[model samples]
Target chain A: MPAKQTLTFPYSRRPALGRRRFLQGSAAVVAGLAAANCRQNLAGPPAGSGGSDGTLHIYTWANYTDDSLAAAFTELTGIPVVVDIFDSNEVMLTRLQAGGGDAYSIIYPSDYMVSEMIDLDLLTELDQSRITGLDNLKAQWQNPAYDPNNAHSVPFCWGTTGLLFNREATPGAPADWDFLWENQDELSRRITMLDDMRETLGATLKSLGYSYNSSDPEEIQAAYNRLLELRPHIAAFKTTGFENELLGGDLSVSMAYSSDAIALTLEDDRMEYIIPASGASLWTDTLAIPATAPNVDAAYQWINFMLDPEIASAAVERLFFATANQAAFDQLPADIQNNEDLYPSEAVLANSEGIVAVDTASTDLFDQLWTKVTSA
Target chain B: MTPAPSPPRPWADRFATRRWLGPVVLLGPAGVWLLLLLVLPTLLILEISLVPGLRLGQPSGGYGLGNYLQILQPVYLRVIGRSLAFAVGSTVLCLLMGFPVAYWLALMSPQRWRNLLLVGFILPLWTSSLLRAYAWAAILRPSGVLNTMLTTLGLPAQNWLNTPTAVFIGLTYSFLPYMVLILYASLEKLDTRLLEAAADLGATPSQGFWQVTVPQTLPGIAAGCLLVFISTLGDFVVPTLLGGASSMNISRLIYNQFLGPTRAWGFGSALSMVLILAVSLAIALLLRYGDKSSVSET
Candidate 1:
């Protein structure tokens, strides 16, 4: 019967290969050029070479920027803010290290990245006297582990890595990271984990009652094995593209960032976001001035503008990001302020840990394990 | 043609002295472009690939073959194998689907509408390939168009979107137009008289097609197949978007090493060199064998 099914669709056997041969032939050349182009861009000069005197270039996440934000900043200050977005911190760091990030005065790097950058001496130590609203940050962010005393970076927004699921499709509400492992059969080929190595592998480590930043080889190997067992059930290692599938009921669950999850939950009530009961990785994105910043004065102004309570509160409402500013949180509507997913209870918070940069040797171990997991 | 040698031109004769100028001027821009952008960059990648465990912005530990040796691992080998399988699979699939459409358009279709039909076949290529891959995601998902159509026809719905099958479908769909275009070009110049001659010799239509048509368009078939094979091998978008969990081909692997958390430029470069070598080999085969086949056919 299976053989009959295979024969019924020619594609089932391995579809005919010659039809689009020529198109792909040229596209292959383009892909090669693109790869080369990526390498060049990585190795190129820093971003501010365009020779715009009035423009303040900012490299940040895609979700952090909007036309209104840029326009309002430009309106308040005469300098126009040019925004460039990066999908991951590693990519941004690599570009910067390669010499392609010099054009931007302002950059948004996550907590661990800020620390890494500071250690590398790539960030400017801010003179707090020049900047206002440093005290307005939430108590936790007042002196973050990544950047104590707000020396190098200012907190932009914070969130947790967790599971987002459609209540109707999932067998039950996934309370913890173990839910995925326990219900592997039910969620088969219908779940997506984050593409980030630290987040996904860290989640597995946490499920086994180890630290999110575990460095022990045995613990790492155990986490890798646990993930390998659940590998067959995962549809893909995706971060952004799973939204449509999750909403359409095609996906039972997806591992997501709190910001992305909260945005989706707002759209559809059935989509529920949860910080796994055992624990999750807490993350904070921060705005920092790179050492090679061209317009330092304008960069300071941009930071001050973001630090303002009215602007920060308005941005959170419009963009669906949790604000790092305590003053900003106070100004938000009652319902948004009370949302537990965005601002989880203290006990839940205590359970979570921020993902810091692991030592070089451990990073290698993680990379090796990740390659094995994906390839397998 | 061996005329008496002309007297050596004097340096004073500007025109004769500068005889090499025209060719130099004409080819210089493109030659320089290929040298700088293509040749130089490839050489740099070769250099980087030799550095063992070279991460961008990190101190390099001199040159070694460690990066290339790393590729010998079974895990990495599997990625290369999967990439080859996709390339070869898609090549054969494209050839099978493209030949018939090319045949109709080239020979049987109305002569007046031939160009229009060819244009229509290539219409999908105008849109971004990334957009096209996303469209396939929409059409192949569980609640998507394919399943809806299948259920309507009382056929079983397929769960293919995040599987190897979807990768094949996306790849074949993406590359089919190029196959048809190339095949049509080959088949259009085919001699109809040979088919008639085979028939006159009491050969049946199928036999005639096998003996005459197939042999005549052998170069086109080879060219089309090689083109598809080479392209599909390095394809990143189709496999990443549609191949789901099992879609870790060499291109994506290379991407991960370079831009992903690993930042292992040495390994990435080594992988890239392998991809470049594979593409160059395919092109060489097309140039050598494809030309020979056409020459023999004529």
Candidate 2:
């Protein structure tokens, strides 16, 4: 008899979050487009009128904030912190652009988004003199490609994208991205890919021995065709909802971010995470102050609070984020320090690539191809 | 009175001409509201729909039919077709399931219990539709409650979740209460005297139901169906949550264009316009048929 389990995941309790994220994002964009003439008004007063309010308003990912973290900061400094969460980088950017996010003093953007925000002049340049623990970041992030010398953003957590599977249910260990296509029959209607267009399409590109950010039209077309072959066997394209299904044996496998997948692995022993042999995308979540921030001092204080080794280690233990700070890594337990999924070996590091914004033509091509894939 | 009429009252006489002020004051707030929030925004969407390849934060190009023409693509056309199928299928299902329950309650059920039963039917609507859709997900999954019961009964388990079947079930469940409410209103006013008169003339129950009952309630049917169809057509929640992969409907498609990794506002606006046009057409049908049926009944 098959073991039956309840379909309950922590995030599933708040099902409206996902739907609301999409709605608000789409609504903001529509409103923005309609009022394009008022774009200049959204720039949010000149940047120089920065003063510390009693509360520090932060805009970050959903799982990053907890009561204890905020309490710790408030205890250390007199300033209270009010946290708001966003589900995706695109949603955050859209909200910010629409001037709905002017109240936020700090924001958490991923690696690629840092560069995009820089291009859009949405970020404020960091003053090195104010921050204390810049030297604690791992060497890889010290002069990262997205923001050289940590000029505008501070690395908070870094991880890679990979496949999370139920070890007992899957036929065999998925050593690479090709495992999905190879076992499509046995895994029929029991697998889910990321809802993200870039991540899903990039995995296919890697499976075909091409770059994750391939701009070549022929290569892109080839990758699109390969994905179409596996589309029918796939159950859904979802970012967060797949966890409960996978846990209850309804889904055998899912593509997930390391932070989310790690939380589940800690809960259920049967789950396993593996980076594909060919390649996967490396991502880093960073803390930065938006240019329109009203409290620059509080924003710097929050970043420094996050960078402190003790606070970073505590966050890692409680939240399961892989910290980018070297000193924080030393403070972790041996088992966590040795966890390959969190800190993979150099060979695995060499195989991964960071996603970047492509040219306009390529972007349009990608949008067109993605529409075809989903519609088909 | 002729003497009091005095000299010719000017055309600008305050009290005589000011009679129009009462209506203007009454309708002013709603008229301004409709213009600012509804008409202006729709006009804005129409303007954006005319610009091709328009991305937010980027300079827009000259107006053209390029964005509208993109909808002619087979991929988008397929999405539109699937949306129509979901709407029409759920409307028919709601009519089938809701009519009998409504008829029993409106005409045959105990009068004291009528309100309670109707409230019970509508209780699900009080919760968030998002939560209801999630509940359906749990019930319809492979190892869910429905499949477990089926297996215990020695019946074949149906794999209905994440398929078009799930979409239909969810849509029908969401809109059935509205269908019942409208039909009950129409059926409550049902003339029982006509049925008695027909029976005395030797007309059978089935004949009376077909000839008298249906024609009298035809307007209600049209109104109920139009409401369900329009709501289902624009429903992004059910299809996004339950329809799973390969279930690309027009609302989700429009969402994707606007916020799903690609910011194609122009294309998204065009899709929105198409959706608006489809709904307008449904309302047109409702006005033409629904009014005529009621008029004939009167």
Candidate 3:
């Protein structure tokens, strides 16, 4: 499951072996990239990112699609699927807008990003007529707030943002966000959190009984202050690389996405993931075709292929993300169906709020306060 | 001065076009590469920097100093100060540590083994720099090898990972080879006659080294320091990987603007231009005061 850690390291292999030759090659590549970036279309996404040749290019989070899934899709559609990964929704958005995602026929954007892309006209209105098994999606996602009636996105997988803690190393099992603030002395320099701006700050915001998508300047500033207090105790704010530390007892706890956290918990019985009492951010990763996507036919086929209950169940079992398809959920093994980390109860999820596309001013404030939080 | 005509020959006839052609052929590809990659991109950044508050996916605003002036804010100034401190602190550490090894390698080590010994010193360079930083993380983390060794030796464990100290260690480790290589080059050509002469003039060993060896290696020192300074100033990996929440240097700050939650390209470009200017200034100083001899002394 480490293969699906969101921020997987890039393949840094160089043709040259010696450091000197590698440095020279890297410098050239950097310069060549700078030269290439000079010519950009900043207004909107390109007309067609290399309209589909025979292959379906999937721009998605790491671990979302494995060889089995791609091979299965290829076998069914007779068109091959190639997968590329991005750690952040914003990064995926930037890649699409920067004209670099031309070859991609599908992208897996998270809940808020789905609507943001729709607003930017970067997403194609998904053809419901061609897609199958839409009715199998859970009632909550049948008409999700981010994309009403699944106009431009299909809810593929969903999860919560919470703490993955080592029960023995930690002072006590943390049940909520306030545990860190309360045990600052005991946990000093022994805790880590997601490096994500929204998730980190949103968690802080939720700890204060405010909205995760707080638009008020004062609330955001308060969250910054609260985070600053905990800053000294945090070993690092990392998205993916804290696993080793947590396992080694260096980091007692880390705020992680449920997908990654569940894998770690399953790896070791001592490790446990818990959603804060206040609530956690609920995120749903959706499959959508870009407005500039080529090979619309292949894209639809890929979506329908994922929608199949058997395939979704297999993917959920293998990749470890909670499936949004009710049919797929029923197909999971009884133990997996009841794994709290994978799928917390409705009562636990009652307070969870899906991060939505906030207004521009609020977004700016979030970015500004986030910059202050990090740089300070 | 231009009127002397030699006997006509095919080689001489070709010289007419060859005069400009030689320079064009020699420098053309390099010039185009620089113009397209370095100069053009820099100019593009400069243009973007002049605009105020340009958001990604949004239209650029009219020309203003909003972005550059924003750097003067206390928050950003602190970031710049930290970056400068890291670069300067790492440069000093590299020189203090590298000089002694370089001196021994160049002047004291046996001639047959000097090259092999230097190669051994720089063997860490064979690995990718990202790998090197990660190795340091493994060694320096609280529950890492260093802590285990310390506890075993009845010493207090040090938690250095994800701190400014960790950043210093990472940067120094990354650039020490280059520093030693450059200093070794300059120190290799030390005029022993001058040192011998200093000794004859009733000077002690320290006095002789200060007066003779120091003066001779000053250019090398300047070159090494500036090279390390420029590289560390803009380095993104070490500080981000090892430097924790508080380690927001200029490179990371600029990265945040362009790629982080906020797509403030105007501000990112502005920050970028400032960094480029700083690096370019360091390079100008390097060319002006650095060793005129070869940098690839290895």
Which wins on lDDT, candidate 1 or candidate 3?
A: 1
Task: Name the docking class for model 3.
Answer: acceptable
- Give me the runs in candidate 3 sitting further than 4 Å from their true place: A1-53, B1-16, B296-298
lDDT per residue, candidate 1, A1-376, as tens digits? 0121221212222222222322333343344335434666554334555235768888887667778899999998878877866667887787787776567788999999998899888899998888899889999899999888989999989999999999978999999999999999989998999888899999999999999899999999999999999999999997666776776677989999998888778877788999998889999999999887778888899899999999999998877788899999999999999999898888887789999988988988998898778876
DockQ for the candidates, in order? 0.28, 0.34, 0.29
Candidate closest to the true structure, highest TM-score = 1
lDDT of 2 by residue, B253-294 (tens): 887776567768789889989999999999899887763443
Give lDDT tens digits, candidate 3, residues B10-32.
88778888997999999999999
> After aligning candidate 2 to the native by TM-score, how far in Å is the CA of B14 from where it should be?
4.7
* 1 against 3, candidate with superior TM-score: 1
Q: Pairs clashing in candidate 2?
A: none
What lDDT does the true structure give each of the candidates?
0.84, 0.84, 0.83
Worst 10 residues of 2 chain A by lDDT: A32-41
Residue-level lDDT tens digits of model 3 in A1-376: 0122112222222122223323432343232234223445321234453353577778777668878899998888889777766667876787677676565888899999888888788889877999999999999999999999999999999999999998878887998999999999999888898878889999999999999988888998899999999988887777666766676677898999999888778767778999999999999999999887777888898899999999999999987999999999999999999999898999998888988888878887887777877887
TM per model? 0.92, 0.91, 0.91
